[model samples]
Target: MSTKKVSIGAKPTNKPATPTADAWVENRTAADAHETMKRLTIDVPESLHRAIKSQCAMRGTKIADEVRELLLQKYGNH
Candidate 1:
C-alpha cells in the first residue's frame, strides 16, 4: 500500500520558523523491562497464537520482543 498526506478540510502548517542554530537531538537509554514488562491485548486465532509463541521460542526471545520489533517496523523506530 502507498501512503500520501491527505487533508479533507483546511490544511494546517507552522506559520513561524525558528533559528536552526539551537536544534539538537537527545540520546536516551532503552527501558528497563526485565523485571517489569509491558503487556498488550489483542485477539488472534488459536492456531496463529500457537505459531507466534513457537516462533518466539525458536528465536530464543519473548513474545514482547517479537511485538516490539513489529511495532517499531510499523512506526519507524527501532
Candidate 2:
C-alpha cells in the first residue's frame, strides 16, 4: 500500500512580498525631508553586537531603527 505525505502548518497566503528596506522605511520618512537614504557601518565588539541583537529580538525591534532613533536624538535638528 502507498501512502501520501501531508503537510501540517499554516498555508501560504497570497499577500504581496515587501522588500526589506522598503518595509523598514514604510511609514517612516527621512529626517531631512530628502528622498535619499544612506547606509552607515560601524564595528562593535562581538559581545556588544550579540547583546544588542538579543535585546532587540526580545523587544521586537530592529537594530537599525534603534540606532537611527539614537542618532536623531543626539544630532538631529528640532
Candidate 3:
C-alpha cells in the first residue's frame, strides 16, 4: 500500500474540532437534564482519589463524567 505524505505547512480542513456553541445549545434536550440527580459520596484512599483526579484532568473531563461513563459502560443507561 502507498502512503500519502502531507506537507508540514498545510492547513487543516475548515472544520471545528469540537461541537460549536450553537450545536451544543441545539443538541441539548430536556432529557439531558439531571432530573434524578443524587449525591454519591464514597471514601477512598488519597492515592486513589489523586489518581482519579489526574486521569480526569488528562482526559479533560470531570470526575463525575468519568464515573458516570464507567457506570454506563458497566450497567448501561437504562
Q: lDDT (0-100) at residue 57 of candidate 1? A: 92
Candidate closest to the true structure, highest TM-score = 2
Candidate 1 has a TM-score of 0.48
* Candidate 1 vs candidate 2, TM-score winner: 2
lDDT (10s digit) by residue, model 2, range 1-78: 999999899998999886787567554567766655566889999999999999999999999888988998999945
The 10-residue segment with the lowest total lDDT in model 2? 27-36
Per-residue lDDT over 1-78 for candidate 1, one digit per residue giving the tens place of the 0 to 100 score: 999998698787878876463242122234653343334578999999899999989989998678888897899742
User: What's the lDDT of the predicted structure labeled candidate 2?
Assistant: 0.83
State each model's CA lDDT, in order: 0.70, 0.83, 0.80
lDDT of residue 23 for candidate 2: 62
Error of 2 at 15 (Å): 28
After TM-score superposition, what is the CA distance of residue 41 in candidate 3 from its true location, in Å? 0.9
| lDDT string, candidate 3, 1-78, tens digits | 999998687687977689888667556643575555555678999999999999889989999788877988999878
| Most accurate candidate by lDDT | 2
